[model samples]
Target: MSSPSPKSPELSDHSKKYDRQIRLWGEHGQKSLERANICLINATAVGCEVIKNLILPGIGSFTIIDGNIVTEEDLGTNFYVEKEAIGASKSECCMRLLQELNPDVNGDYLDESIDSLLETRSEFFQSFDVVIASNIKEATLKNLSNLLWDYNIPLVYCRSLGFVGSIRLQFREHCVVEPHPDNKPLDLRIENPFTTLKEHLAVSEVNGKSPWVHVIHKHLVEWKKDHEGNPPKTYKEKNQFKEMIRIAMKSDEENHEEAIKAVNTVFESAGKISSNLSAIFNDEACQKLNTKDKNLQFWVIAKSMQDFIKTENNDLLPLQGVVPDMTADTDSYIKLQSIYRQKAMQDAENVYQRCLNTLLNIGMKNEIISENTVRLYCREASGLRFIRGTKIQSEYSDWDKSTTLAEGLECQQPLMELYAVLRAYDHFYTEFGYIPGESYVEPDTPKLKGLVTKLLQDWNIRHPVSDDMVYEICHYGGAEIHSISAFIGASAAQEVIKLLTQQYVPIDNTFLYSGITTETATYKF
Candidate 1:
């Protein structure tokens, strides 16, 4: 489509509300982001930080589920729950504050524990587009994971313990149509332009005031005719082609330099697939994606595109749906741009229809693939990219992943020893009524230190944690640090957007970050 006119009356309120983000990802991605209904299981600092980010971006709706009453400790951790809300419901306090960030975004609150909600109103979890669970118990998280897995919904598990944070992403096999790869290959279809584009260029004659683009197009047709429809294949032939364009220039003409400059583009034969595209087409995932698959949007677009190419019998990829700048007159440039854009838009529509048919054949419906989705897919046809995250089953069963995860132990940056201490703390919290250490009360440092060692041994981690580090973490009693929560919350929110919009690569399976030293690591099972 042509550039949106600044004064156009067709722009929607959504476009105004999300103007900046719409520029980052296209209107389609913004729409996807706006359509999401996110759920946060806890109203802690990390959770509120994530929700704050999403609320400002105008997500469709969000539900905060927390049954605990706000306490003095909670006030110190979460910014939204002020001292005035000390005895109020955690979910209600956070919901009120987060909703004020953006009135356009809808908000809901369930003043009940996630375990009770899962037991009584289990269907409540299925309606959300994605779920974010933070600071949940191990058994509760496992139950939530299994439920979300059954429903095929994505879940981002986040945790922030004082100075360190970690994240784990779980979803069914996912695909990304537009991972927004850098270094997009040149998409010039000069070798074999589409019918409308070819016809437009065939009769589009060059005048004295015509741009250098017309000069190149005129010689391109002549060279093809002379060489039996073959472009210059080798370096020698390319230079010979350039010399031909140079010889055609008028010596006395003031614009002879423009015609001579057309030589640089005359030999650019680059409309075919790149090595990445070749690999994508031959991917085992692409080969095996069929009726019983997850019905991801990317795979649907890709399979429909395969059908589109097969029917056309043309090996060229779909148009990138772009028009580069040229030295043409205003009218000439618009006309030239329209020719390519119209073909690309038409090709996208064709792909959309084929996608409907593919869905129908697989016992699905047209609603499975939106028109905007297919349109963006075709616009990025040459730039089609996909990423598959590690399965939760694999993350649970993979024993070899310990070596990779253990790399965090090598860095003394902040000491990953807290990971084990937290697990032990959780064990203590479950068995006892309170956490390892409490404020204004003497800390049980000796008992907690012993629990930390036992927990470390249970996990097969050989890292030797110092007595002081364990004491400090326990002494702090896992109170939320605003700086750590701010950074990790923003990071998790970014990943959630990527997953919802399928615009960029999300966290693989695990991410370990230390704000103390700004050290980060990403791992896969």
Candidate 2:
């Protein structure tokens, strides 16, 4: 396991500040953000907004470039600048404001436009960890894109108009673009064993004596066992409770007996206890409600529960004094405890969504064809202006229809299993757990001999492996998973974090915007 990050002086005082987000991205992700250095080419209003979000998370360092002074209009929309600072240079003002959000960040501001310096300097852009150009002219966009691309540096291109915004991210190579080795798929990491139990408890239409309701019903069973199988607590709490039960139990004492009233009272009391516990478990305080608050309240609760649940080890009474804060009674404790389990499930779902989103968005951000790869191919053969590849074929095949990896490989007719192999390589590095230079099967080699035999039998192609040619096809011909639409920009930023910090693998080359509709398919490069 990787050692924990050294306690940074930049820690926040609040625990709940990012509670919901922390559950999604985890503390390691937050630390990855802390160690990133990002560059903003033009600090426009939209750029400032993106920076505001980035700064709050305390991205490692920022270099902002702009020559324009802040105008009065900026005060209305730019959250980082004040009305009084209208005449000041926007870059410096934004830098100062961002630094106030987190003292750990080191921000630099340039009072001159990016255009003026580019004419005489080529090394200026090389200083940043990642380059993000916001609201720049199209010509400048192309120039910056080319510069970053030539240098193999990751680039983020963004544009905004009114409510609509577009963002693009580019990572130069697979090694730098992929996720960390330790990261796992969000879904697998969060599947819970107690889902059915939690769901049954939450259901209102359950039979009173169902096996699923045992957690609550067991209270009665335990109480009865404690009272020598005679329900002594009910008798002690209320004589009416026991007398009515006794009368109801006898065959000759049922003439106008009010047993229903006694039964209702007992249920009402149990219901109250259940609600109290539910309140505590569902409590906003218990959820650690904010990521901005970095006080680690969840860890505190987890630690306390570790101790509180220990009484069960000694076979001692648990419900008497084992109540969580604010859950004073057994019913409340039970309900809150149930809520806690539900919240755990919710937290896991959120993490899965974040990871899934991040995986897809990385592809959308780098929607450009690999110019370097194209150039390499061009050098091998003269007059190769048009490369007969899957991406180009798909573009001309239908009116924006998605292409499959198998089809792409068929069209290319390469000397190897190009697309399939690339996918395997991508999966191996990102989610399937494989690293380069490690002793194992050839990169992208089938994991099982049975599957290999089956695929070879079906495809009628058998090739011996453990060579570099297979690895190249697997790495390059693979599809990219793209995250599109509303989450485009956020996903771009997430990918940059992974690339810069080497904490997460980049997503496959597939742009999926299922938000508009559940229609998701492949986008090849």
Candidate 3:
């Protein structure tokens, strides 16, 4: 096991330092990034490049394992390795340089190769939150992939060859909270106002401070009480609801734009739960959150919220604890905001203790969850997002579509040809112990031609890959190009930040970057 790291700076410190990013991803996402421990294997130019990005953003810690001695070639691309460090171990060189970027980002390095570590202490792999392995053999990558797969850890397999670079993520499953959705779900609860809100609206006297919002809410409550306590359901009933608002409006209140807007806007299909919330109710994770698993606060809270939705007469998700800016006076708006916020907190607390009982039922220890976690989940309950990713291994075995996939490729879409070559590249390196032309001084077209042909046959693909494409790859001498490595490194680092913070959607299974044309393409298998 790795040694413990110092706690990341507190939220107050985060606000002072990470103010900009906190605005972008919110404090919750910043916390996730700060808590994540990333592991990288082989500190090649690409690996260090990725590490560089994460360190700058203040990831909690990182551990790099590499056994190679730095060479003159390392100085060409790896910014982290200076000329003075040419003879040094690549892992140590990369770590020293990366630490200089962010003192808060604690890290260590292992001088042994990944293969040696895998042989002796494979369980050590389980200690990381995510793994980035670059410039590795296929068998070794697959071993790491499968090991991490079983443990539910995300594995980023990145490669850079010549002008081609690609990153394939092997994640069994991952859930993201901050999708940065364009449309944020709101928990207005307009149709089914809570007891407190209803009681506030029940008064006939507004004391001249009531905003048009309260006027409209009060009018609608009076109408519902006179009727069967249901909001407008049909077209005529909506018209009827509007008429009720119109009647409640005094002649001078006609100029009250808030009242006018509420009449036209507020009553449209107000009673039912949102379609998004309904979809959330159908999610398998919420349904499957039983006694066996109580570790995830989100899931545990979601499970409890599910029960709340079922049992509550409102039949709605919990209060989102938010009130929109209104036309009310300062006191009225603040009062309304406090009501919503306080009710949401009460609802949240009920779910929190309910889920705590669930944790106990699942045999969890005391205080396995915190009230703050429950509060966060409840506040974002309506805006909660779910993502289900396809497994990375699914992409490798689907080569039968290579013909169709290649057909979609316009001539010299280096990206299209790069994927094919990468597959064949894996085959060549595994059998020959080196990339296609890396060991030879001259272009080994014949050797490469045979390998490509064998790879196509194995995949049962008959599509023709131009001979020029094969030669171009061979001309690269199966060597990592500086610009290409840098591109993949930056891209991988961005995705890792997304993966850890989950603020933005991470690239789905595979991303191919071609320096030949400076473009990237995404594919799902």
Worst ten-residue run, lDDT, model 3?
264-273
- For each candidate in turn, the TM-score is 0.78, 0.38, 0.78
**Model 2, range 1-525, lDDT digits (tens) per residue?**
112234846546543665555555567567767777778877666566556667766688898889899987666556678887889999999888878887767888988888886766767877666787765554455567667766656676654433223445555443321222342111110112134434544553322212222222333344455556543344354454445344434443321122323333433322112232334334554344333322222222322232332322221111211112321233443554455445444433333333334324433222222332222211111111111112212222232332343454445433223323332333344444443223444433444233333443444444433334354333332211222222445655665665544444454433333332333333444
lDDT tens per residue, model 1, 366-469: 78789877888777676555555554544433444655435655564343555556656666767665766764325577777777777656558676567876
| Candidate 1 global CA lDDT score | 0.74
lDDT for each of the candidates?
Answer: 0.74, 0.45, 0.73
By TM-score, who's the top model here?
A: 3
Deviating ranges (above 4 Å) for candidate 2: 1-32, 176-491, 503-525
Residue-wise C-alpha lDDT for candidate 3, range 1-525, written one tens digit per residue: 112245976667658888887788877788888999999999988888888888888899999999988899888878888889878888888898899998899989999988888889999988898999998887787667667877788888888878888898777555555566675644556667788887776663553346666766666677788778976667777667667666665655532445545554455533345564566668776666654432365577777877877786356666768665655566676777788899888888888878878778777654767888777766666555555565554555445456545564445465666677677677777877777777673556667777777776776666656777777777787577777887898899888887787566777778988776788898754
How well does model 2 score by local distance difference test?
A: 0.45
Ranking of predictions according to lDDT? 1, 3, 2
Using TM-score as the measure, what is the rank order of every candidate, best first?
3, 1, 2
RMSD in angstroms, candidate 3?
A: 7.1
